[model samples]
Target chain A: MSEGEIIIRAEGLTKVYRRTSGGKGFLGLFRRRTEEVRGLTDAGFEIRRGEVVGLLGPNGAGKSTTVKLLTGILTADGGACGVMGRTPWLERRKIAADIGAVFGQRMQLWWDVPVLDSFRLLRDIYSVPEARWKARLDELTDALELGGILQVPMRQLSLGQRMRAELCGSLLHEPSILFLDEPTIGLDAVSKLRLRDFLRAENRERGTTILLTTHDMADMLALCPRVLVLGRGRLLYDGGLDALLRRYDTEHTLRCVFDGGAEPEGLPPSVGVRREGEAWTLTFAPAEIPVGEVLAKLLAAGPVRELTLKEQDTDRLVARMYADLKLT
Target chain B: MNIRAYRTAFAVHARQVSRYRGAALGGMVTQAFFGVMLVALYEALAGEGDLLRETATYVWLQQIFFRAFFSTGGEIYEQIMSGSVCYSLLRPVDLHLWCVCREMAAKIVGVTMRLLPMILIQFVLPESWRMLPPDSPVAFVRFALSLLTGFLVIAQVNMITAAVTMRTLDNKGFSGLINLVMMILAGNIVPLTLAPERLQAVLRWQPFAQMLDAPIRMWLHAGPAGEWALSFGVQLAWLAGLTVFSRCLWGRGIRRIELQGG
Candidate 1:
């Protein structure tokens, strides 16, 4: 509603999916069973206007479910969520004019139609004024580099080109907020970087609030300063990305080639050791035991030939977080 | 809401439907083959007379507009299965009305693309198998209006099929069931006139008959002013009933829809 206002808020939002398991035998056929699977549970967060926030979660952790609920695509089974100060599912059509969404696994464009035709259809559907529509279309086409593929059918475009076109389509209406589910999934390095840059510019220039769900930690690092992490249908963390990473990123690895048969031992049990072809790898959380202390222990145990230290990769950090939370 | 948006959707869907000219050609050939076989079978059983003549026209009309009887909601199925239907749901328009308009466009355009070629088969067939002209100019007019009403009814039927597909997550069972019932009761399998006398009245008044059988009968025999009114009244009644029922089903289905993919 205003600058720096809360544009999106979820309070104890939850969803449980009813899954039916068909019966097997003749008598069992009449006794079909329906099981409720928790999709989201008591998930809550607040997103300010123009803020870019990433949703981090392992598979089936309700990241997409959260997006769907916020976008009015699915109704939450418990609690409430408000977008632009209105309940999304209750006022879905009213909110439709103010928000746009892109799902990476799905194509909103018509497969057999030319890209521009689909754009035109969306233009009319959103009721964008003709003059503003043309101007916005032109700008988006240029920005997303979809100018050359305007006349191509969606099925004929490469994945990278199609995703760019999808971004352009979602932005042409100048929605106040955008929801992207796995927007950069299956994208090449160059395309992913370009997509991140385009999204950043869009947020800056239009002050469009963005809520993106992605498995790519790099995308989260580059685009979202703040993130909400969900695990096992529950909110695990909600704060700055750096803070979340720092909490779990303490685990560090050191690999060193021994000069001879000097066995590396007598180190604290907190540190894990593994033997490779020519080097021994040691892993220890810097928070539990200081990196310097572990290094000294390793040096005393073996004559180091070559050594390198590496922080836990983001993918592993997330995996470890999930493991710690018992979400896997 | 600009009515123009709905009109544009109709236009776009019509364009999409018109793109399948090749399919229409293939369908015409198949329909003509079926038409010839049905007419020959009817002639051998019924002998040459007014009954055979009327049956020939009925058979030809069935073949001519066969495309309309099939569901034109293939895109809805694809969208639902692929989870792309979220885009359709996200649009500001009423989802039910939008789908109705789309299916209407597809049915009209899909049938028109094949109508002429299939009609031409009437002239090419032998004398006994040839389709007859409408009973009179007034009958033709009634037939035209009734046929348009039939499209509305079938469009609602298509939407119902889509709703069922959403509920079941499988279109084949309901789609096939609907097709079979429509073929048997709507006179596509055999003209209701040729059916046993006791069953004829019941079959003629059923909802499925409103799709084409009732309209084609007007073309064969435009009985009287009162009969014309009754014929159209039945069609409109069925259309209204179906529209309401399908809307309810579709609204409920959409509220609980869980798209197939992530």
Candidate 2:
């Protein structure tokens, strides 16, 4: 396949879940009924080969449903979806061979066996050649820092270690597409960074298509340039993260520590300042007042011992977008 | 189907079962104790006769084959409840076939671990308590064949149960009900011969009896070669029919499966 090929395409994808209500007791069965819960409604996006795309949303925002439909774990109730030019649900097995998936909450490894054993089993399941398996395993182990825990049983490993091993297992076959559903969920900071870096390297070196779903904005900033935002079964935004932030005009925070107890004066009306001890935090909207003007005014007010500008936090930016769009 | 994937699945299950040697040993001891108790109960009721001997052998065999063939329903229930069964569907291999291979491997490992010690213990007991070997080499071969076919039928049944569980997303009391019914109908609790003649005739024709009773009876040379041939034919037919039925059910159920916990 050619690089930058449109590997994932979905148009007006929709899923409606009919959930049973109140069937607890024997009498309740007679009163049981079905409720139609819309999971995904007209959600559409396209991902090209070698692109690392992040799928971000709040709880019950149809992010998981979108991933499931693409992965063929669930059939869409309406619309069309194709992975590598094949219908995912209809030709699930055929598409499965070319895609690797890791669901953070659900493990694909054997619980009681050593991590290596699970890797070997996956190699066989994917029918990877011996040489290729060895090469890939070595690469992943090094990248994910799995050397110390390779022989440990999965039940014995910590969640972070197990997640790293799971990543290795999923990549053993060198699939063209990788689906990571909250891969860094519950991981420690170091493990999360390692995972993000490994994924970025994998995408960069192999040109593998990746669709990642995560609640951590840091993960999105570090790994994905393009993002699909879902909310209440609708695609609210699909574009670059930087563009989304700019479109929302998120507020930036400036923390200033002065040499003495001198306070800043003549602050712009758009700037909101809070002080605790010697540290003064200035929050302002860049669209209303220029950042340079805010800084020059602060410098004129006092001899700044230290100054740090925290760009609009991606989390808050996305949160504001969700609020403005009424997606939360 | 991917042969390599199926073989890998089988190997993984085999290793998993082997890792729990303590549990396997514990199960063997428990089954052996139950077998001895049943033998005594049958001897007290039936007196010193061929019926006692046959029933004693049946009891011993039942303990080994019960978990090996018919007890995989719990495994299916667990996979569905845990939502890990999605992996099976995502693989390129046939999901039912993969489950069959994995479960068969577990059962084989379980039977291998328990069969020898149970048989040895039975032999060390009094002659009346000991299980008699197959009547002839042909009977032994036929018994082995029947056991293989029996496993297929049981696997199909388990697959159907798993499909239903996935579709409904609730398996409470289903396993218990199915186990109780299978125990009585498959002749694991009491031999079909001990039942009323009409009832025995009807039960003998059922798919449940084909899983255990037909195989055990054929091994004991309970009927003529023509009857054995008929039993084998019936068992094969059930296997084929159950296979198709379970596959259809699974295909339909998977599309509607809303996997819990992502």
Candidate 3:
């Protein structure tokens, strides 16, 4: 394989967990029960070098399981997965050397130690050379705004500060691929935007391949150009975020204000209009009726003081997709 | 294996322990109090002889090594329960060795911070209450080696317990059972030599005896040359056996690891 090639390839990857149940009392012990949970079923995707892809799913939808499979933390029951041109489960140590992972709910830093000390420890753990380690530390500290909090114990830092420290520590080794699970889960608006900006810069400047899983729509809109949506342990959508929006986002709303408290409209059969006082709102599928023609028809109906057109929001579009897939 | 990675793992635990020096000092006071109580009890029972002195010394040694041998497994249990063990799996190092290094570092820090003060207190006590020291440099070196082996044996047992915790995801019952069993069989509460011959015969071959009883006996030069050699051999053998057993358990346990906590 050449440099900057496909770094992660997974095909028909599957995992099933056998969980014990109903084994409580004496009779329950004799009649032990077991149920199979499908963690990932035929989940497949490919991520190239320097690509920032988002994995989106509801709870228990196998988002975290897929990341764990790819990272070699959990072995797959079937199918194939290759990370950095090697099988992740079989060559986990080798792959771990080339990737950095941050599970937002779990911390990798020493709790009582200073953030800088944790970074230094990670530097040694990854065996990053002195010169490169120093340069990377300086750059990350500046970019992540971690200089002021470097000497603070990790347990003493706020959630945002601790997360920033975590991101800095994960990057000190200069891994080619970075996996972030819910990186912006509990951050304030400003901190979330700052983290998104830093991630974008890291992707642009360092060409780091990032796989992000988050529930935050803003994070998806701001960071990932390509998204993989999983529903019920299956990959439902894998393409550009814009394409997902365009395909599922068909409805558009048109709000109009009539002149002199008068509403007169001979709207098309495809359009549904709601009237309240002098204002009228029309909802229609843009794919069936062109926006230009609709505006012309609305103008011809009556004298319009003002008009506004709004597309469907992305979150609603995603929710609709989930409902359509029966994954909600 | 990455030597530097393991070293850093060790250093991190050591630094964490150092940060909790106040807690360690408090632990020292508690351990010293227990040591004095045990020494007086043994003195009353044994009535002031070499055996009484030896029992007192054993009590002191148990206090010194309590955290090192007994509590290392608790750390693993806590990590497993809390789901932070996922970080260990994510690293590019051998998880077993990394855990061993971390426990070793904690043991070093615990010994340094807690053991010296307890020993100094014992030294300052009345001669009748004082415990005997190692008789010669050779004997002391042998005692140190035996204690080091004892640590390895305890670490192996801890590794097995940790692997079991990884599989079960609940460790309170299992860890408590293991501690209670070790306390009895390893002579932590009372010397195993005082037990019946048949019980001693069985316990001598078990791994728990190798962890504490053998090492303490060797430290006091209480046994003959042949017995000392046998004790060292038995500790080494148990270490080897437990290491293999724990490795297998770890392999199977990791395959089923759920990482339960968020």
Q: Per-prediction fnat values?
A: 0.46, 0.52, 0.46
Can you write out model 2's per-residue Cα lDDT over A1-328, one digit (the tens) per residue?
A: 2258799999999988887787678988688878788899998888899999999889999998998889888878899999999988789878877999998988778777789988887887778899989998998888888999988889899999989898898888889999999999999999998898899889989998899999999999898888898999899889887788788765888999998778889986668989988999999888888889989988998789999998887778888988998876
> Regarding DockQ, does 2 or 3 come out ahead?
2
DockQ pick, better of 1 and 3: 3
lDDT tens digits, residues B148-241, model 3?
A: 8888888888778788787677887787798899888888788776678998888777889888787777777756778778879988988899
Least accurate 10 contiguous residues by lDDT in model 3 chain B: B253-262
TM-score: model 2 vs. ground truth: 0.93
Please give, for residues B24-64, the per-residue lDDT of candidate 1 as tens digits: 98998899999999989988897888888899999999888
- Candidate 3's displacement at residue B260, Å, is 11
The fnat score for candidate 1 comes to: 0.46
Error of 3 at A148 (Å): 2.2
The 10-residue segment of model 3 chain A with minimum total lDDT is A258-267
Please tell me the interface RMSD, in Å, for model 1: 2.6
- Compared with the true structure, model 1 gives a TM-score of 0.90
Q: What is the lDDT of residue B73 in candidate 2?
A: 44
Q: What does DockQ give for each predicted structure?
A: 0.41, 0.50, 0.43
